[model samples]
Target chain A: MMKRGSGFALSIMLLSALTLSACSNGEGAADGGGKKQTINFVHWRGEDTETFNSIISKFEQENPSINVDMTVFSSGDPYNNGLQAMLLSGEGADVFVSTPGSLFSTLLKSNAFEDLSGTPLLNSFSPDLIKSGQSDGKQYAIPYQLVYNVPVYNKTMLDKLGIQPPKDWDGFLAMCQKLKDEGITPILYGYDVSPGQLINTLVMNLMPEDDSFNKFQTGEVKATDPWFAEALTRFKELVDKGYILKNASGTKYEGALSLFAQQKGAILASGSYSMATIAKQNPAIELGLLAPITTSGSDAKYEGVHTTTFMLAVNAKSKHKEAAVQFAEFLAKPDIAAEYANATGQLLTVKDVKYDSKELIIQSEWMSKKTVFQPRLINTNKKIETALNESLNMIVGGASVEKTISTTQAEIDRNLTK
Target chain B: MKTRNGTLWLFIIPGLILYSFFFIIPAVSSLLLSLTNWDGMTYQFDWVGLKHYGDLARDPVFGKALGNNVKFSLTVIIFQFGLSLFFAILVMKNTKLNVVYRTIFFFPTVVSSVSIGFIWMFVYDPNIGSLNLLLNSLGLESLARSWLGEPSLAIYSIAFVQFWGHTGQVMIIFIAGLQSIPKDLYEVANIEGASRWNAFRYVTWPLLAPSATIVLAYTTIQSFKSFDLIIAMTDGGPNYASEILSTFMYHQAFTYFSFGYATAAAVVLMLIIMVVTYFQFRLLKADRVVY
Candidate 1:
């Protein structure tokens, strides 16, 4: 009888332990003492944590009725995966950052974010920038940072080779040939990383001015159109001509940057985000930016700019909706944007921010001039970008351009349900 | 006996409930989700029946990933098992040198797979890697090809790293099983004028069957579930040439936001693992072996 009683007690204890383990403490719940409401904010920029915290502190000082609990993920797929799980489980942050791509599209489609069309913050950003984050004519996210992708050449190397920065396709090809003849790698681009950038550059340069590429995204036209085929063929010609690095398919993005910094490569086809890192690696090297050259003999030059690099949105289901919106508004303030840009060396979409770095000034000047905004298709369909990247990789591996384009087109068509 | 049985049931009920809540329920839910057209973030989902499975059947990327997984499993079985058994046999006896060798061999097992992947990435780097430097120093420059970059060699390169990281664990299991074998059996074989090879072939081989089964099952499952190492090293890249099913499913679910399709891929992977493990149990069953 005693043993039986003991067994019953033990079972009860085990069950209690299991139950206790399943329970959470609810740390962020509203306090009954009438303290400031806590607004949970999550972002995938661990590199900007310190700067972001300082900005948050300033906001908290201004708005004493609100407290922000910020969580920073270390970036890449893990952040996206975790954010997806949290949003699905109805436990996501009140305010979160999203890229204006597949993730933003998913959030907008699900109505996960509050409609910010009437928000005062919306008026601060340009309509062109704000429209990129809208779905079905409703604003969902506010612009934060701007990133521009262009051809960065080593000014010192170009001067030594007696070649100026190219503005057209013939000059670009001639510079590449000259560099290659001098036993230098002409282009330091990694196919494994940021493969879509070069493809975007080529498409922007080669596509007909009729905006057929945009129409293709809406399913009005196919990717196997003559314009796309021509772009693929031209890209393959560069690969076949050995203008791109011999082991580019294998080279990583960081590896290519290191090569450029070491003066092993004359030109790096990358974005403004790399400027800070490049300067840190080789401060002595002078860098110059040029628009991606056109092969169609068109006199017009086109530079690609990403107006919405990382934007903040308010969660529709957040309990502290007012506080979350206030925090987002604080982030869009011009002073905060300037402080963020100064601390992180990133370009902001906020109006009238001062640039201390000459490199940023040069990039901003290019941005203020002739530029083609990145297409909505590249942002909307991640599968298309991945397919294009993989196709480029295969082309570098000696696959035929026609087969690569067809396979990529098929992949895109199959995955275009959205 | 009835009271004892009741106590046993009481003890097991808590574990059973936890398992049902965490594992079985989620797994069954995922199976149900596989038939839907959910993008994970959306509130609305449509039941699409077996459409996702149909798509998987036609997916060339899925085919490539499965083939890579099979190759990865086979290579892990051969190299991890073979090297571990050899090392176990070498160090089974209690000796100082053997202890040192055991410690050295087992060191990598303590390191996380992410760290191991990063280490191997540097080792396989084409320009500045130690492997290429060694090849150049040995006057074998022609043999110094990109290890993780080439389409044909990337999977094998990753497999070698997996083998290096896990062989120590298998060796330790083999050592435990070796120690459990009765010394009298070896004495008896020697008394009968049997050679060392004969003794090992007849006695050690049969006794180690259980250990080999454990090692094989573990290595097989590990090979199929490989993600972090591949992600950290090549990210299943060089044109998805080295993409396994886990990475493919990850891209679908996280990158493409196709939760339904990703779950279908998960279900297929689970079925593959179940079928393979079932066969392994049958083939390596110890019931027929005599002590």
Candidate 2:
């Protein structure tokens, strides 16, 4: 009985080893035979995975020798965390998608991305948008889309209420008041995620000519500068007047978008990305884009345009660099850019890529005219952004605005020293 | 005897290799990393010994997170242990219905915490959520507020979900302990004219001490290491009100790229759980009550 048991155990062990070897051999065969070179592409566009897959298929069709293996992560911090780990371990994707911001800047500084300078693909994009993806005059990323952060008004509601889109801050306030009097929620703002966006737009509109924000970056000016304080005061006035939603603090980004789509609110202060979602939800709802309303009594117009929406970059340490570069080059073609814009509701930055979406057309008009490419806080220190976002929320929660600003400024100064 | 010892070592080596590779090595490396100023993205890092700890000391948000973690741990232990113990006692008898009841009670534990968090988020959502809708339907409209948005209530709301998710495991453990107690102990007590209260106090309580310790230790560790549910439900927000140590560590490591600081936070959490678990074992250690 003991010998039979031992024989059974031996057979099992031999079987297990054989199975493991077979599996490894199968993997080796798949990787190292007459197959196409596989280049992994990771991106954080969970919503646009279908669009990305379609693009990948087209790219593969054009370049038959290269296969693109795509992985999609949910956007925001989860994607950032996963990408950081992958890069540190030298197992990062051959090609990855990133926005041209502080995270990208940090990765670029660390030499995580391949220098794509002198590539013919770089010449296709507008010079300014290309410059946005560069660090120290070396191109590290290529832009995929142009996004504009401006207030989107419900044109159907506005026409029904006989309120034209406002051109100035006073007119904006008057319109909000009229909406409130008509028992309509004036604005749908999700302060839970980053209250700073709303405050930043206000500051940009109020202090367009003032370069004092740059002073705060250099420690030459405090966050409690009168311009910033005045902006906060105006925001507070809006909150006190109930022009902003009552439960704005509790509402999430998607929740606010849903509310806007349901016509519960007359206006949504969001980026161009929200247009596709809102349109998908309520196709009949007419949407109109407005430039940032001027806070000064003068008639000054400014549009907060974002140049780098989604950018593709090659990993410097990738084993399949040639294949990755080929895929990236293919993505930069004007036809592919137009197809990408059609698939995903983002505007292309390539010179000759003509796409027709009403929202994109309006955003393009603003881009052609008076556009100040918004300085994303993601381009700044994470602590400073966190401090600004939290302090803005606290101010909205009835904390002393002056104290919040000074304290946040102090925090920023401390982070700078670190 | 020598051959037997060699065979035992052969059996143990693979497990030891895995443990060393997966746990001990990572833990030691994390301790070393905690003393540096690595931003995670950059290859270069400076040895800033205890500086992260100093920064953590000065960070009020870290303090708030630690406090939130402690509150969460305590709340989960109370609800999870109390309700689980009560249910375990209820179903300790080997009745046909008891199997069904136990299965029903343990169902939530089998589901992923992320799914539970998402399910609870929908229930807590202010506008179309069932919690608020139910309240409004019953003419309790004033009580219908955003449950996860409120700072004071958010931590408890997450703790309640944690409690709901894990109470079943605790119940199962307690049921095993209850089943192991011989029937004659209770019968002898009944023959001696002892009441159900007296029988339970003298016999069942002391016998269940070991199981209680196991449940407490497991639940405490789980509470301290809680991340996914909070991340999925709150993302530590409505302005950092529901932020816990794990979420804060994650933000520092990934969001802020402060890997060294995040590792320090992880070390502190590890030390806290170890100390708490040690004391728990000491206080609950009971002599064997063999029948």
Off by over 4 Å in 2: A1-35, A192-196, A207-218, A291-294, A297-301, B1-14, B286-291
Every prediction's TM-score for the first chain? 0.87, 0.89
TM-score of each: 0.93, 0.92
- Alpha carbon lDDT of each predicted model: 0.80, 0.79
| DockQ category of candidate 1 | medium
Top model by TM-score, which number? Answer: 1
Report DockQ per prediction, comma-separated. Answer: 0.57, 0.51
Who wins the DockQ comparison? 1
lDDT of 1 by residue, A1-418 (tens): 5698899999999998776654322123234444456677888878788998999899878877677778877576888887777677665478887887667877878878888887787766766666567778888887677777666778888898789877677777888889889988888877655565666676676667625545554566666778677767766777888988776766778778888999988878677777777988998888877555666356445655444667778888877788888888787777787788877778877776777786777667776666666653444677765776676787777789878877877777777645
For each candidate in turn, the interface RMSD (Å) is: 1.6, 1.7
Expressed as tens digits, the lDDT of each residue in B1-291 for candidate 2 is 999999999999999999999999999999999999898886799999999999899987799899999999999999999999999999988899999999999999899999999899889877667999999999999999878777788899999999999998899999999998888999999999999999988899889888988899999999999999999888887667789999999988888888999999999999999999999988887543544
lDDT of 2 at A281: 94
The weakest ten consecutive residues by lDDT in model 1 chain A span A22-31
Clashing pairs in 1: none
Error of 1 at A325 (Å): 1.9
